[model samples]
Target: MTTPSGPTVPFALARFATDAGSVPGLVVGDRIRPLSPAELGAPSLNEFLAAGEAAWDRIAALAAVASDASHSDGTTADAAWRPLEAVTLLAPVEPRQVLQTGANYRTHVIDLVAAGRAKDDPRPIEELREWAAELMDRRAREGIPYFFIGLPACVVGAEEVLELPDYSEQHDWELELAVVIGSPAFRVSREDAMAHVAGYTIVNDITTRDLVFRQDMKDIGTDWYRAKNAPGFLPTGPFLVPARHIADPGDLRLTLTLNGETMQDATTGDLLFDIPALIAAASETMPLLPGDLLLTGSPAGNGIAHGRLLRDGDVMVGTIEGLGSQVVRAAAARVPA
Candidate 1:
């Protein structure tokens, strides 16, 4: 299951079942190679990532040797290679921190603002469009990216079922590209931001639409914590494709389908602030640790823009070019009396 040049193999780290229980594995073509305790040195992908670049280099080297040996012996089948379908895919990594960007996609922001104005404004349609365009242009030049912290405890594997909170009726889906930090980063420049990235993964940034704004305090604006950080709110991964495998993160296409219908589809090219900008912006005040996740915002066609909020029994399928896809099913909340 290993590749001749392990570094070139583009491994997707995951956790799958073992006689002893679940263990971290490196996903190769149609099989997974379990990591030994000596190789892993830790139980989770989070620790593996924090072990530094040298640890990853060693993994790649070992994989390359295994691959070479397998090919040379003419016995490519090894017991270590387990069927991919038989294994359970856990969240690729347990992030130390989760950072998410808001209103970072050009079309998504414009659509939201325009939709709000259409509901209550008396301005002409064309005038409203003109104003929105102008506003975006000025904001791009003068504004910085808006970021919010998310609770890592809310993260779940892609295959896990989503449980809706009883208090919110308007649960929504936001498909975004998530960046996994490879090294410690603080006050990093945009020019050198890409180097700090270890890999890319998929994240469905689910939101409670009704709770986004505090009705009790209008001036307080958005309440991201309450609205976005619920258990199973963030369904992430199926794979974490190495950054080296992704030539350009900004050019990847992202698509999301809800119950067999394509709801959100867009490319990363539409991002108002690209990956480098987001990394630089996020690292300005806080240090980004290995395995930390930074979500680069969602594109247009979210439920908020289309009036098609998620409901119980809804199934969401999110896909990002190069990284992989994630399917999450939603269920009604089981509230206790």
Candidate 2:
């Protein structure tokens, strides 16, 4: 339905292993709004999304009123109305847990080391030390160094803008491919791991760049988690498109623009570890459940280290080839005067 602000759409709220259902929703001027859960034949918000694509049709019907306005190019005549900004964009999935990979892009690694943030060898220092003696004996080999983690509170949604806290000065932005789990999977084979995927969306893994590098030493738990999990660290979506539609996860054209200048531009192929490898490696340990999220990491050329950290009123927009785009405003953590 259309609100005084603009046309709206039924935005879905997804969950796993729970009775929550999708709620009726509308996109009122740049925001995704829930119409009413009960009206969609579901008891709870998560339950409605769990109903699957069929429910999406019904949810789309909720937007029928707005969509019928006879406009060109999937937009309406109201220049001031942007449905994506009006409603509170909730994380589409209720991930039992969230897992992310570090330094998965080959070019990103090269650039990182050039920037003096990462070591040249992907192997950990301890492993390097162990292999040093063996190298003298002529049997040393290099290996990929990967870091994985379960970031519980590092979740937010499409419409929400992140607040950079005062205590931190080194804020950063990472544009990643966020995968939503569709089924329960554990130690799944590469071919099968993708079957567990629910869909894909964009993720801006906002990081505290200074904190990331300050605690860059080995074996010690840097307060990176706290800095990483700060409120609004992760902002995702405009919507989640089913995997069936994305023919090649590795070929998508991705771009990140800060304020208005393009800051990062690269394809998913730049990834050192492709999507399947990441899925297989992650599932080897934790049981990935439907709605669980995985962030595929970002590429080279981000703010913070590469450029200037984001500032108040700075607008960051992330766009993927097929997937829709999302915009975030960088405002000081205070009520605008």
Candidate 3:
């Protein structure tokens, strides 16, 4: 029912539910212990993250105590520490706002540009790739990232089933490294953006490829609301590793496998605009509150690029280095018999 840990020594934070209710918890190795809100003086993870870098240190102190209290030698910890497998893990954070980036990966955008070429154009795929790569390089040097807003209502835990909307059959998977905001950021510069990050997590940004473009209004661009806001479309987190535990967010590896086949395998470094730029750009127009998610964009190897879309009973397992991993399955909605 539940799962939980991380890269450096394997420790992290997450929300879990039991028969009593739900609580935020610290996971060390294969065991977990709750961090009561009253004790931390913060009602939820949003408040806790709003506490800024201090919250991480406070959680560190809690981890020490939890580890001490959880000694296996039959103590009151019998109820305090539970095996990681016995709990139900929820989406690590309940973000008020989710800023999603599009085509921010260098190679990814090149792949997309090459994929969308007109059939009449006689350029070879390799040559087209080269031209697109040059264009992406130019954009990286002189461009801001393409961003879209996402609904938090779509957030769901990794274990949840994905009911593919029958309205479109071109659903795709895009696993990415999600930055968890700590302090409120408004118009912050790129140099100062990293300070506002509380931690990191994995998000599978599932999309309906065909619904992305506006069919009715041909002039209008992508319609993210209809294309991306399906229930359980954003499958997030098995754990939220504190920023302190991650050496470098830009260098982390992101991987997603579908039904045992590798779909996306890339590193955050492939992003045309890195995490700091994303945070700075996203926060420039609006305030990014604590617990908000800033997605750093997805890499290449998407269904649109591959032409192989999701089907009923397809399973996806997404992982990010240092943060954690998530497992999700797609199930088509059934009609009444």
Q: Pick the candidate with the highest lDDT.
A: 3
Report how far residue 201 has shifted in candidate 3, in Å. 0.6
What lDDT would each prediction earn against the true structure? Answer: 0.81, 0.65, 0.84
Over 4 Å off, model 2: 1-88, 117-145, 213-222, 335-337
How well does candidate 2 score on lDDT at residue 316?
85
For each candidate, give its TM-score against the true structure: 0.89, 0.72, 0.93
RMSD per candidate (Å) reads 4.2, 7.8, 2.5
Candidate 1 vs candidate 3: the TM-score winner is 3
User: Candidate 2's residue-wise lDDT over 33-102, tens digit each?
Assistant: 4555555566644454455566557655655555566376667653533455334445655566788778
Q: Write the candidate numbers in order of decreasing TM-score.
A: 3, 1, 2
Pick out the ten consecutive residues of candidate 2 with the lowest summed lDDT. Answer: 1-10
Question: Judged by TM-score, which candidate is best?
Answer: 3
What clash pairs does model 3 have?
Answer: 2-87
Model 1, CA-based lDDT: 0.81
TM-score of 3: 0.93
